[model samples]
Target chain A: MSKKKITIAITGLNNTDNPGPGVPFIRAIRESDRFDATVIGLAYENLEPGIYMNGITDKTYLIPYPSSGSEQLLARIEQIHRKNPIDVLIPNFDAELFTFIKNESWLRERGIKTFLPEMESFMERSKDNLSSFGKKYDFKVPKSLPLTGAHQVDQLFEELDFPVFVKGKFYDAYKAWDKHEVNTLFHKISAKWGLPVMVQEFVEGTEVNVIALGDGKGNTIGAVPMRKTYITDKGKAWGGITIDDEKMLSLTYDIIRKTKWRGGMELEMIRTRDNEYYIIEINPRLPAWLYLAVAAGQNLPEAMVRLALDEKLEPFHAFKSGKMFIRYSYDLIGDISLFESITVKGEL
Target chain B: MRIKRSVAVSENGFVFDSSTGDSFNLNGIGREIVELMKNGLEQSDITQKIIERYEVEPAIFEQNLMDFQSMLRQFNLLEE
Candidate 1:
């Protein structure tokens, strides 16, 4: 019998210059002999020297954004399917995940399977979901409020103590501050990105992350806990050490079971001086350093892909529980601007 | 495969028995092998079944099974 043909369509390859989370996923596919795939970029311009261009994908397609509605996006993807007929569509970026989930049924009807969870599930597991999930698990989430306007920003500072965080609903978080700096920073953010934003009570302590892959059926296939030793300008953990913490792992499992989460997801956590773990927020996408987990011996992306393909996924191999991975950003050569910014941000 | 519960499982898969806490996020194949081990299947039997069920060569299957078993053993999820 001939080998079954499986085509995968991945999005957002042209958005960033560096190897984002998509690189590792694509690498896993390239390493695996299971399927054939064509990656489609959804950005306005082409990104060369990218992981895909650097031999990660079998083929690459640039799909232009529609000037009109989502139907255009669907039509474009459908057109690609007519030619290649993708068996699975795995979106790596947040917006791509959102778009795929929004048009999930339509794509499924067209015979393209996706690994997205329910849209409502995304909302329920969002950063806002952090506090609620924390409350359910008897943990405290930092006091936070969704920003309404620049005027309300003052009230936020007044309501809370100093060192509040001004964050976007999307990715930015854990920004440190006192009252005066936050008050000024609030206006700067509002002027750039409109409200409502997230103003969170700053939890000072060591930073940690919890990652897990689920079948969306209340089965957590695997989980990992790590600490943040370094962070990037884009708010990604640059270097980190994995640690073994019983309480944090329990909390992570509790949240996953409660949410019935699927695919790959990450949790941001803070350890107070008293060694208490406080729930910060949940990022529903894969981390850029996810490959570290795979390198540590738990290939989460491959597991998710196999599970999505209905292949029997083996229970995760037990690895070194506290294995650490430190991400080193390459090509910072002579970039004094980056150095200055790191100094100002104090994240170096 | 054998799945001995540690003091670490939280009704969810949050495992923390460092004695067996972290390991390969097993692919479907690895998961099956572990389950078989947990079920008291010997490595030889598991390899035999893997060769019969999957298209991988017997030698490769044997090596992978041994490596996977060693990994599990190293993590304290299995006894010698």
Candidate 2:
């Protein structure tokens, strides 16, 4: 009997004290009877925290985060393949995906399957494109413009509006400064992070997230909508409530269709008093509570894994639309000072 | 720690909280523990059953069982 073989590689294992979903993902994958899995990281810091104790994977490799370009990253990944020969590659970090997308064709040539969407579609769905896509989809997006420098931003607020948001085009952060000190930091951040800086009209409303999984062919397998009840100082949603809403699902699907998106995508949205969900930004990868979606009866990772293996797609029952999921900050477990200082501002 | 009066467990791993009207799906071990709690088993009885059926070390299992019981108590899933 031919042994069913599948090699799973999880890249971007940051060994930092920062929390990650990779450890749990590794555990979940190892528990599955369907695949043989190995977890790999670009650095010791990138390795999921506490992975040394889990003993969950068939193997683990340490590869540093690629710095030069797509060519360098491709060569490094290819070197790993020469040793272990992965059949499927799952990039586990935002930065890693940016580099990996450029090498997608190279990896695909080796018969490795990935869940990445098209590069053009990816750029069209990013934070910089949020406002434009919102207009196209007939959704409310804050009035904003891309900031190339502080002078451009100064001109922006001078003509447009006040109390704006200055964020990175990618998941990286733009150095934020006071209104008086804006220009210097804007230049510093733009030069460091590399982006069309995001300057948007800050919308005051409920911050919500809608996470879903779709086959590249356009079928949305499952979705979970949530509101962050608590966020860590580091900007990670420490605690959130899973909310089920048909509107959230439809709005998410609308964006997904517009972008020709595939695989897992997390849409950040804000709901105004009039009950309209304004498009904030679309994260083109899995959300933090992806496991909660699994706990809520829509196992997206398992579904994606099945799809990658070319197994017949099973009928996925939609989760209870109004269900709520609450995830507490993992930092609360280890950081005493932060725990004592933490405050709960609203009903969870 | 105790199972709240509102928590209900079925023989097939289904759980319902009468207080919240919410239902949950528990794993086999979770089902067994919930059933044992319903049957009025003491901590020792539950531990004995778990130790005999699973490959976990007795000491570690006992510690984890106590911790799990404490957590369930905090969640109001048990009756004291």
RMSD of each: 15.1, 15.1
**Model 1 spans with C-alpha error above 4 angstroms:** A1-5, A12-19, A33-45, A48-52, A64-68, A174-180, A187-194, A322-348, B1-80
Q: DockQ of every model listed?
A: 0.09, 0.02
lDDT of 1 by residue, A74-106 (tens): 887888788777878877665456777888889
Worst 10 residues of 1 chain B by lDDT: B7-16
Off by over 4 Å in 2: A1-5, A15-20, A41-53, A172-178, A181-188, A320-348, B1-80
Instruction: Note the clash tally of each candidate.
Output: 22, 17
Interface RMS for model 2: 7.8
How do the predictions measure up, each by TM-score? 0.70, 0.70
The CAPRI class of candidate 1 is incorrect
Residues B6-80, model 2: lDDT tens digits: 677877888765433345788888888877877788888888888888888878977878887776765546654
Provide all candidates' interface root-mean-square deviations.
5.3, 7.8
Q: Predicted chain A of model 2: TM-score relative to the true chain A?
A: 0.83
